[model samples]
Target: MKTISIFTQKGGVTKTTSTINISGVLAELGYKVLVIDFDTQCHLSLGYDVDKETEYNVEEFLNSVEPIRYAERGKHQNVSVISGKLKLSTKSLKRDSLKKPLKKIEKDFDFCLIDCPPKPINDDLGFGEIAIFASDYIISPVDYDAFTLDGLTTLIITLDELQQREKLTAQYLGFFFAKVEENTKDFKEAYRELSESEISSLLFKSYVRKNAFIRTSINTGESAVFLKPFSPVSMDYRKLTDELLMKIKIDAK
Candidate 1:
């Protein structure tokens, strides 16, 4: 199975939204997709309509003595989700034990999409390195803002250091511009600035447009792909998923 981690050093860049939308679209296309919500906020889990009272959360699965299985099957389309609890990030589980739950679930799904949390304040590099180590590809959702770009630079540096130290093999699958508005002067300048930088090569051609439908869908516990399949935002996500699949195939070669 191929595992992709949706991550960003900065939050509020549509990381969980992208994860849910992409997973839903992939499942609609007949792929057996499993989404694991690793963020402490549990936003992605809520998007899948998984109730908070559910007993089988990621924390319980990781710390369980026996083989853990997901309680809810599929909510949005054909995609199954492993919900995250607020306590998942507070457990004393080791990295090896944390990895075991995912490894066990990987056998049942064709694609695994991990929604990682924002980089930790104490040690940004540690979380990025561990997420990269577990993923086959990393997709960074970026907002066209100065501070967000600066955060992206820090993330790139962390990934570079990890690759040099551990000889990591995961592909950096490029950035997706979230909440983009090309008409605005600030956004236009920000996009141009990022395009001219060394990291420009890592930017994806498809960008998600700023849309009210996105917020509405999230508020109602639905993905944009499922809420408005014919909307521009939905089409953008579909294109992004296609490009991601192509990149994965090329990387495998």
Candidate 2:
């Protein structure tokens, strides 16, 4: 499987939402997808509505004793998930702890999407390092704010450090804006600056406009794409997924 990690250090970004929606769209396209919720809050698990009924969570896999299991036929056909738990937040972890366990499960799917925890919650590296190390490609959601640059910088720095100190096999597929406000000048400026910067080539074409239905659809145990495929929010996710797929194709060249 091609493992994709949706991660960023900044909180309140669309990490979980983007992870589920992107994977949902992939499932719609007939790709076998597996989602791994590596966060303590377990929002991805709850979004999939697999939080309570699943027999295995990331905690069990990370422990390396229990065999990895999945919540089958999750919200969509061809989509399955490994849920997340609160215990992962406090659990002590080594640098490559998740890598081996993920290897055991990922090969079964066409793609594996990991919903990473926020940086400040666990520790200096958090589950971020392990997740990144295990991924083949990464898609970080950037917000249209001053902090966006800082967050991207920190992410790139971390990846560089991991490549130097540990073994990281992932490459950036590109980062896209989430919950965007297209009409605002500030938002436009942030986009422009990023597009003109040194890492300008890493920017994506998708603009995920601010949509209230996103959270509402997700909270009700359905991805926005599945809940309202024709809604503006779902349409936005489709664009993001399209751009992501295009990027991946070009990268394969």
On TM-score, the leading prediction is 2
Residue by residue across 48-132, what tens digits does model 1's lDDT show? 6787556467667656546555544434446777788775543354434545666766778889888888874234233334555
lDDT of each: 0.76, 0.81
Q: State the local distance difference test value for candidate 1.
A: 0.76
TM-score of each: 0.89, 0.91
Model 2 clashing residue pairs (backbone) = none
Clash count (model 1, backbone only): 0
User: Which parts of model 2 are misplaced by more than 4 Å?
Assistant: 52-54, 64-67, 73-75, 89-92, 120-125
lDDT of 2 by residue, 164-220 (tens): 766677887778988888999988998888888988888987878899998797778
Q: Candidate 1's error at 21, in angstroms?
A: 0.5
Q: Per model, state how many residue pairs clash.
A: 0, 0
